[model samples]
Structures are given as structure tokens and as C-alpha cells.
Target: MEIQKTPLKDCFILKPDVFRDDRGLFYETYNQKVFEKITGLKIDFVQDNQSVSSKGVLRGLHFQNGEMVQAKLVRVVKGKVLDIVVDIRKDSETFGRSFSIILDDVEHLQLFVPKGFAHGFITLSEQSIFSYKCDNYYDKASECGIIYNDATLALDWHLPKEEFIISAKDLELPSFEEAIS
Candidate 1:
């Protein structure tokens, strides 16, 4: 696997070495030893989560606050998506900045999202399967998010605003400024 650093500290884009044959292709997703050696950080992912959504579906700009913050390894399982991560760590240099990448089955790319960032994604294919490995268990009380269209962040989802299918809960999330405040 090749670890590509993002502008945000501790975040990375992992490109696995794929092996192909007449039948299909194979690649090692995660190996704790290799991961630790490459990233220099050891994370134990306790929970694995998966979701399926149709094109235009948008989820997140979300994170867990305080002690419940989670580090995640996220990827596209079967389709394409516009994955985004925002550095929300107040003490970090890249705080408030956002990064975006196109993750799809074709590239087999994964993003390593450290505990201090908020993450979200929008499905770009007719359907998509998204999966993630989180280092911590989830807590409802610790859940927090910035609205997808926060003016301060001005994220480009790639798709027009009218094409997005945002949840009522997500649509009601706080703005980037309001969230930090």
C-alpha cells in the first residue's frame, strides 16, 4: 500500500497494490503491521460500518466530539463517491480546511481520517456501497456535524445543489463557524 498524505495532519490516502489474474483482482485491504510501519500510528478499529445509497445521496460532515472522537479508514465498496474530510482540530495548522477525493471501485482507494476531522460523502454512481472502520464505538450524545453547504467552507460536492439528497438531520446541522463556536 502507498500512503499519500493530505494537507490535514494525520490524514492519508492509501492506494493498495492490486494483483490481477485471468479470474479477477485481489488486494490486501489492511494489515496492522504494514499499516503501523507506513503511517507510524497504531490504531485499533473496534467497529466496522457500511452503508448503501443511491446517486445524489449525501451523508455527513460529521464527527464525534471529545473523548468519543473516532479515527476511520473509509473506502468505496461497489461504486463511486465524492469523499470529503475537514480538519476540525482547533490546535492544528490545517484546522477549518477541507479536502476532497474521488473514491470508487475502480481505483480501490481508501482515506485514513484521523480523530480530529469531520467526514462526509456523496454518491456519484447509480448506487454505492460505502464502508468504514472506526477506532471507537459510537455515542449519540457526542455526535456533531457541520452543514454540507457551510458558506465558510464552501465545499464543492461536484454535483449541483439540486442534485443532492440530504437528510433532514444533516440539513439542520450547524454551520462551520457555528459548529466551532
Candidate 2:
């Protein structure tokens, strides 16, 4: 596995070594020892989650606060997506800044989104299978998210704003300023 750092602190892009044969292809998505050695992140993911969405579907900008915080390792399995992450830690040097990357089935790349950040993705293919591993079990009371299109951030999702299909639940999320404050 190769660990690539992003501008946001504690975030990374993990590329795995793939072996292709006449039968098929194979790669190790996560190796505990190697993960700790390369990223210096001592974490044990307790729950695995998957979401399937169609083109233009936007799911997040979501995170858990305080004691329910979660760190996620995410990847795309069946299609393509533009994954975005924003640092929301009040004390983080890169607070409020965002990072974006293309995660696709072909490349088999993964993103490590540590606690103190909000994460979201937009599908660029006909359909996408997005999966993630979370270090902490979810807590309803602590769940929260900032609006995906927070004006302060001005994120360029590479898709037309008019084409977006967001949930009413997500549309009502607070702005980044409201989240941090």
C-alpha cells in the first residue's frame, strides 16, 4: 500500500499494489500492520457501511461531533465519484479548507478521512457503490453535517449545480460558519 498525504492534516490517499492474472485481479484493501506503519494511524474500524447512488446524487458533508466522532476509510467499488472532505476541527491549522479527489473502481483508490472533518461525494458514473469503514459506531444524537454548498467554501464539484439531486435533510444542514461556531 502507498500512502499519499493531502493538504488537510491527517487525511490520505491510499493506493494498493494490484496483481492481475488470467483469472482476474486482486489487491489487499486494508492490512492492519501495514496501515499503522504507513499512516501512523492506530485505529480499528468496527462497522462497515455501503451506499449506492445514481449519477448526480449527493449524500453528505456529514460527521459526528464530540464523543461520537468517527474516522473513515472510504472507496468506490462499482463506479466513479468525486470525494470531498473539509477540516472542521476548531484548532486545526487547515480548518474550513477542503480537499477533493477522484475515487473510481478502475483505480481502486481509497481516502482516509480522520475525525474532525465532514465528508461527501458526488457520483460521476451511471451508478456508484460507495463503501466505508468507520472507527466508531454511529450515534444519532451526535450526528450532524454542514451544507454541501456552503458559500464560504465555494467547492467546485466538477458538476453543474443545476444537475445536483440532494436530500431535503441535507439541504437544510447549517452553513460551515454555523457548524464551526
- List model 1 lDDT by residue over 1-181, tens digit each: 8888988899999999999999999998887898899889999999999999999999999999989999999999999999999999999999989999999999999999999899999999999999999999999999999999998999999998889999999999999988887
Give the alpha-carbon lDDT of every model. Answer: 0.95, 0.93
Question: What C-alpha lDDT, on a 0 to 100 scale, does residue 135 get in candidate 2?
Answer: 98
- Give the per-residue lDDT of model 2 (tens digit) for 29-61: 988898899888898999999999999999889
- Candidate 1 Cα errors over 4 Å, as ranges: none
Candidate 2, lDDT over the whole model? 0.93
Candidate 2's error at 132, in angstroms? 0.2
Clashing pairs in 2: none
Clash count for candidate 1 is 0
Candidate 1: residue pairs that collide: none
Which stretches in model 2 have alpha-carbon errors above 4 Å?
none
